[model samples]
Target: MNARLRRIVTSAMALSLAVPLAACGEEQTDAGAGEKTIGLLLPENKAARYENFDYRIISRRIATLCLECELDYRNAKSAVDTQKMQFEGLVKKGVKVIILDPVDAQAAKSWVNSAAKKGVKVIAYDRLAEGDVAAYVSYDNESVGRLQGQGIATALGSQASTANVVMMNGSPTDPNAPSFKKGAHGVLDRKVQKIVSENDIPDWSPAEAKKKMTEVINALGPEGFDAVYSANDGMAGGIAEALKSAGIRNVPLGGQDAELPALQRIIRGTQSFTIYKEVRPEAETAAEIAFRLLEGKSIKSLTSTTADSASKSGIPAKLFSAEIVTRKNLKDTVVQDGVVRVDLLCTKDLATACKSLDLN
Candidate 1:
């Protein structure tokens, strides 16, 4: 393994030991007859990780931490008003600690402030919500964008310095979106020949990304841009379809969130790369932080860093590192870590590719 991959693996192992998901034979905290509750509010269901990994891992960890602590889970479905209602509902239920991934980070300021007034502590999960947040847990998002930019440059090979690129950014509502865009621009601005077209995709919609890509293709023609930088995997799927429709091939395309489809596309030689941020550590850490808050214990050991939101500064935070996943490291990273099962990734049509990669 390379130095970066080794560091990521080592850090993850250390975190897993610090806050184990399964504490076998360990003494558990009991709430007696009255059960305590922890509120979990996720931003959307569009991203596969929120439901499949974040919710499941966090819930399981919370259960292991305190058997009597019940989780009040709610998904906003990408609606700000809906999330506001959910936040209010959780606070009204007397839930003390709430884990929130805001649909609109800026709009969450008022909601979080209100929750604070009600003696409710909110832990900003994944996306940084603005307010008096008790704690924050997520990956180093700007580095994620830097990885994407580097992936595109690597895919472009000798033409990287003189390559024309199109940038497809994430939602305007998400605070992390600007960081990703800024980080990508930091590299692309100095590395690439020029950025021909750029757009901030609303809701990170795949269809809208497809429409934008089609327009860019029509405006600039097939050979105008040498590469495409998609902020996440879902939009990358649409951009890939647009490229296929335009009969344009061999253009380097990059994305984040190592989704199943993006991995398959990488194997099929369509999408070039995807950033894999291990959500297990992120979610489990958040759960541990929540439990600590409930117990009135200090989270100093867990959160070694601080972050700033619009309304709050010096908020305790724990940010994990991410890795760049390509066809080459597919087996070593996601498959080895059990993030994606071989059976789920290797379909009948992809059997040959899977076998070649020794994925099965």
Candidate 2:
């Protein structure tokens, strides 16, 4: 056998001999080649998960399955051009496969096509890039919007009938923003009095969200808003800060991504609800699928459905569910799944609140 083929055989045997790694009731291992390299291109450092969870878990899994397999990692820092350059570099490095969370879906299509031409398989890691891809793994993102809306409406309760809220949306640059807005608006549109004002913030920045919230609060006069649907937790903090400065009390707030302070605010009754996307399963599952394709194995069991992007059709997709955590189900949702480290969320400051949720 050729050296590369022999290496593949040896690595496959070693991986088969090891127990499939498990977290949150699923198993994953490298299936195909023994000692091949994979490239992982993440979008930015602005979102904490890209570095903290995604990088660590994907690297660990590759190490467990094939000790010699290297991960050529890069962070685009939210630059589309930089990502394209990185993707080209990975292709030049002769990586067997690439897993990418794109900086911009539509802008990255050319790179995806170029890599395909060179015979390097591409997996759309978290964000779906616009192209024919090997596979995709993410949560029910639209459903998350619906949940956030419901959470706000529920928190508003009787007030929803007359509630005038503003929306602080994610970056306009992200394709997901429109879908998330669509989902939230679907529920909120029917019940709420009106959207007093709204803007799609650029780059999903907390600073920008805060600035927007302040501007809206001032423009709307001192009567203030009944609630705000800040797309993610970081931006939610921004809205909350604006609200507090204006002395708006007992107002419902909507958020997602379950950043720690947001959940704590839910406990403190400072914020209403946050959506938990639970990245571990999505990250691990994507890594496993990439490994399978490298090993020349089928991934039918992992993917029972599909996703359609503007540039691709019949893409094998794994869509997981999302949960809306009020102060009520914090334990039942994120904590129950072991998605977040309790020690981190349930610190000395939030210790009582964590026990209140029965998380420990």
Candidate 3:
């Protein structure tokens, strides 16, 4: 989520709920008389998903139902202050509903509380927010982490212990990062020896990961490292580049986010696995939730249970499923379904590798 997006979503909720209680009166079906603006707040531009998928999905869904309704979107750029300021701006602009993906869950409490006081409905997106919220939408993050950890084990085969494993973690600022780390460690820390280096990447930046991996390569010498457990594909690509520059081959690495390059790396066997959180399904879920909220309908049918945030309990939540992606499962998971084109995954250098795996 981007910071600007958080404010936009929160503002939409705030502005919509701000409608005079007497006018709304529990449930008013009239679309023209009630809320008008819908805010979509994302945490940062660190991941391509925010710009490439979320904005379009949300805006298109809003347009389908409410032609006159406006969508106010923003990106926080990984700054709590910036996100908070954006929230205030959206509130001032009078957005009716807010779909928030917070940068700092702790720092977002004040905005959530204030929005609630003013009758705004805040729907926590991908990442959960603190305090009162209307609803939440995200994938099973822990499960995704567990899948990544399990994939690492399978990729290592019988020689996993001989391989030195390094961790390139996601941002500490994000709540999901810790969960992912915990889940991964639950698997890797048990059997793996020599935890070479563990780096908590800032803003999930590849450049930062490249710097850290380069340093690790320098410290450990050129070739002894066995694997890099990069939190996402962006950082995994960075780690791969560092390894290539050092001329250290025979490494098995893992990453999440089936980005184009990561998929290519998987095809070439430079990267072992990636967690594919498909964009269309995730976006469609968000779209459905927003429309449901707008119609004053209970989305209870859409959600199964609740996931509590650090400062909030029993927050309504809907979590989608995530799948493990490897070169082996590439055809079934992404390529066959056309989530990622096979031509993109199989480049000239990777052609031999792809064919060996029976990839057409």
Which candidate wins on lDDT?
A: 1
Q: TM-score for model 1? A: 0.91
Q: Against the true structure, what is each candidate's TM-score?
A: 0.91, 0.86, 0.85
lDDT of 2 at 22: 21
What's the TM for model 2?
A: 0.86
lDDT of model number 1: 0.87
In the predicted model 2, the residue pairs found to clash are 8-34, 32-295
Model 1 Cα lDDT, one tens digit per residue, 1-360? 465765665555444444333211222334231127888989999989887778877877787899778777888899999999878776766778999999999999998998898777899999999988899999888888888889988999899899999999999999999989988888888889999999999999999999999999999999899999999999999999999999999899999998999999988889999999988779989999999998889999999899998788999999988999998999888777767778988989989988999988
Name the regions of candidate 1 deviating beyond 4 angstroms.
Answer: 1-35
Q: Pick the candidate with the highest TM-score.
A: 1
Backbone Cα, N, C clashes tallied per candidate = 0, 2, 27
Give the better candidate number (2 or 3) by TM-score: 2
lDDT of candidate 3 over 244-344, digit per residue (tens): 99888868889998888888888777889899886655665676777777667788887787888877788778888888888777877766545555676
The regions of model 2 sitting more than 4 angstroms off are 1-35, 339-343, 346-360
